[model samples]
Target: MELLFIERISTEQLEDLHRISVHTFRSNYGHLNTPENLQQHINQHLSKERLKTELEHPEMRFFFAWVDGKVVGYSKLNTGQGQTEDYGEDQLEIERIYVLEEYQGNGYGGALIQHAEQQAKTLGKSNIWLGVWEKNPRAIAFYEHIGFRKIGTHTFQVGQDPQTDWVMRLSL
Candidate 1:
């Protein structure tokens, strides 16, 4: 494993962003969902146009994890009005954090979460939160290992399928 570096994504990297987002998302969730649902979710949330709009949002931030000059993962953070839920002004929401299948267990996911925490602190946030799918025990364990606690639950729609997500939070 080469040194992992995280870069704040710029609008010029829209194509790279879109590529990684779709690939990682499908790789992670495709087998667990119907083909129609998976494709619909990708089209609705990971499309180039949607990614570009998110990249341009003032309260939203995107970061890419790079190793040996290749992007291996990415994370998306939201503050204020950009947050999916109203966790309040002092909190930052990690809307997405994903590492490619081949790159898992190499600490890239933890690095991405650390990056999010630093960003949240920089923005004067006291807490950082995210929604993790209830079925993903690996993710739930990972977040728990990092000191995040399940504070609530919410419905996360992947296409037309409604799924339960554990709302986890960590106080800075």
Candidate 2:
């Protein structure tokens, strides 16, 4: 079945989006991080109020993919917002791109990335960037396969442990 795509989530969809985020995040990262940390991440990132606030942001936008009447994946992009000031006028960043485990490895991720890149181009951004956890080699490889180059790194705390992440980018 073809997935129906939603480019702008409506207010009514906020709760469903939050539910999807929590479910997808837990299933995808639960084994990769401590349960405590994973729980913390979900609490901070997937709350309905937080997501609604994000959607209300003037510079924030997201794309969602649904199949069989259920959302399976989503990707969000936000304008520089200080995160890409180093790269300046030509750059914007992907805030998040997630596909449920069952929907992964099926080209859904690539489609979303391509859509994000096009969105950046439409915004007149010359470059698009995203951050990836160091532990996710598969994700790194996938990004590279799609033309993202690793340019830098940053340290972040996932739950209670400090970890490094790679900054990857592609020219739009």
Candidate 3:
């Protein structure tokens, strides 16, 4: 495997962001969801326009992981008010950390989490948190392995379907 490198993504890379976001989401969850629901979720949340707006947020940062010049994963980090939930000023959110299915186990996701932690620490944050689908045991286990503890639950929408997400936090 080629060594992976991480770079901050700029607005000029909106197309790449959109493509990877949608593709990774679909690859990860499409089989478990109805096609209609998957399409609706992608159209609503992962559109290029929405991504561009998100990229412009002052408190949100995006990063892409590349291996041998190919983009294989991405992460979104939010601080201050850009966080999906109000976890206070000392807390940062790992809003999204996704790797392409083919790239799993390559350490990109773990690297992204480490990056998030470093960002939070540099910003004087004491904690980093994220919501993982309750049904995703793999993600939950990964978080646990990384020292995250379940703190609460939140409601997340996948198209029109209501789902539960476990909020996990790691104190830095």
For each candidate, the alpha-carbon lDDT, in order, equals: 0.95, 0.80, 0.93
Q: Which whole-number lDDT from 0 to 100 does residue 21 have in model 2? A: 79
- Backbone clash pairs for candidate 3 read none
Query: Ten consecutive residues with minimal summed lDDT in candidate 3?
Result: 1-10
Ranking by TM-score: 1, 3, 2
* Model 2 Cα lDDT, one tens digit per residue, 80-125: 6635335676787886889988878788888888788788888899
> Mind giving the per-residue lDDT tens digits that candidate 3 earns over 93-139?
99899999889997788988988898899999999999999999999
For candidate 1, what is the TM-score?
A: 0.98
Candidate 2: which pairs clash? none
Off by over 4 Å in 1: none
TM-score, each model?
0.98, 0.90, 0.97
Clashes of each: 0, 0, 0
Question: Model 1 lDDT vs. the true structure?
Answer: 0.95
Model number with the top lDDT:
1
Q: Give the TM-score of candidate 3.
A: 0.97
**lDDT value for candidate 2?**
0.80
Q: 91, model 3: CA deviation in Å?
A: 1.0
How high is the lDDT of residue 94 in model 1?
Answer: 97
Off by over 4 Å in 3: none
Total residue pair clashes for candidate 2: 0
